[model samples]
Target: MAAGVARSDDLRREPVLPPGFSLVTLRESGDAFGHAQAIAAEAGAATLVWVRRFDIVEFAVVLEPDAILAEARLAHYLAMNALADALAIHSPPERPLLFRWPDALTYDLGLIGGGRLAWPADCPENQVPDWLVFGAMVRATTMSPFQPGQTGVGMAEEGFEEVDAVDLIEAFARHLMLGVSRWQEEGAKPAARRWLDRLEKVTGVRHGIEPNGDLVATSQHGVERKGLVEALAKVDWLDRESGGPKL
Candidate 1:
């Protein structure tokens, strides 16, 4: 999947991205997250890598956080919260938005899709990361040209209508900018709260994010903290057998 720089004689003609940002359009088959990470140091912050696809909104943004990687994991919450807000605006009001901790978004009870994050390999946990890429992909269309069950998974099978991927991406970009701006002005705690509000609010369970990006949940009976960094170490969203999203 090759990538091409968006061509515009005047930089002002670019998309109305966050205050200072640039766009890199990738082929539909390209991996936005992988490409963003590959060019993170050079592209710098606010460089958005996107795929122009009809079926799904696939893209990721590069961020230059001022906080250490340990604390900056909270940035994931910022992105997820922004995404949920954006989805809420464009999708059916009844379509539920819930997270599977660290990273994973579910529509109603069925798994739709979620976001993934990547940073420089050499960047230490205590050091402020030079660049970080938060990528996301949502299944918009069924993509089942023939038999629906044969594909194993399809958005239509999951019962989402009227929502397409391209519009979702545009809305998400706008919301993400707003969410990040809030993060800059306020603290991560408020951002975390906003994210928690969108997630499935489990009764009798209090949720919080640790400094190192781990997920903490306190139950009336006991408190348990799931390691976000560790959970991210494994790829849970994609199906190993089918090589796509799991049903």
Candidate 2:
């Protein structure tokens, strides 16, 4: 698998996670997504890997779904919905939180971070994989000097002064659990609708998430679909070398 920056081996204190979640906290330089992937199979479901950093809220969780890989990927939408919902819980009211298609998250028109999903490479699409990993990163504080044309904003810079990394992770976990329950009891429609409602809208186009997790856009030109798996494989928001959000 293509990986990110190699982080230091220094470990950090663990945070109090919800029931069924086992936390593995890494140092500031460690990559939560990468670490989670490395141990996903043996770590079992609900194993959460978190990176301790002052500038970013980075974490990933392991999931074992009963559905086939194709349909199971729709869980990504649930994860995104839960994430956006978590941010909304703490964000200042009226701050617009939006998603840039399959992955990236934006706050007030500025990029914050995004989510990513991964499964076993050898697992067949028709079979339910042994595990799936969902990871997300949110910019809590800006490490670089801001430029005039900068396109991203940190949580701190957006009136989320009281929110911290732990708070976001906790909220995300609870919301994610709620999303999963809703998916199980009420079906995927609720999760799908939550995601679609927050998607960046185009005036002339109508957007919807397919049952298999693809994005379908309808317009005068007819309908177009984008594969969720293909887009996730590219992980547009990740800086391959840095193992962090794109700057």
Candidate 3:
């Protein structure tokens, strides 16, 4: 189910990923997520699509799960958890890293890039899909002029002086491997717990992750279930005009 490299550019150093992980390197202007979705079938599992750039860290990976599409969608949470874990590895002590429910990642109360998932369009909800792509981005530095009092922050602004785009991608790959292994061995609970813990705290509300990746919120009023698929349909953290995370 694995072993392939779609492409590699000469400018950037090849990423040091784990065994079975192939790389597809793109130029700065390329789209990591879309490219991975486009080439997932040929690339097979563990093929990481990386966009070479200085202002942002962009990457995505192909996954082939035994479970059906709905169940496999839980991989989104696992990806997000691994992303946060990777950031934490090089973060300043006690830096606040969080997620905005289904897909957005937040750092120190500011919006950063988040995770996105894709599957073959023809695949049924109950059927196993040929491939799934989990993609993500993080602002390594502000590509545009910074505005005062804005809620968006880049890694440089948050005291990550020693980290770079390659560092993040390499870290995320390692963390991703660990997360997937834990989920496969123990169950979704381990991954779910880590994902839930990183969620921004909601006043007086306790959160639970449903087996199918739904968000179960239990507060004083009652239990409200937010469908994972629906929530990920429109990403609130993304800024369409700028083509990046909202500022």
List lDDT for all candidates, in order: 0.70, 0.82, 0.83
Report how far off residue 156 is in candidate 1 (Å): 5.0
> For all the candidates, what are their Cα RMSDs to the real structure?
5.7, 5.1, 5.5
Clashes of 1: 0
Sort by TM-score, best first: 3, 2, 1
> Against the hidden true structure, what lDDT does model 1 obtain?
0.70
Which one wins by lDDT: 1 or 2?
2
Off by over 4 Å in 2: 1-13
Error (Å) of candidate 2 at residue 235 is: 1.5
Candidate 1: 10-residue stretch with minimal lDDT: 1-10
Give lDDT tens digits, candidate 1, residues 11-124: 223345656778898765777888999999998988988776544567888999999888887888888877776666655457677777667777775566678887777889
Which ranking of candidates, highest lDDT first?
3, 2, 1
List, residue by residue over 1-247, the lDDT tens digit for candidate 2. 0011112221233456779989888877888888898999898999988888766788999989889998888889899988898888877787789999889998887888899998899999899989899999988766655778888777766776466677778889999998888888988778888899999889999998888999999999999999888898888887778666676
Candidate scoring better on lDDT of 1 and 3? 3
Evaluation by TM-score, superior candidate among 1 and 2: 2
Q: What TM-score would you give candidate 3 relative to the actual structure?
A: 0.92
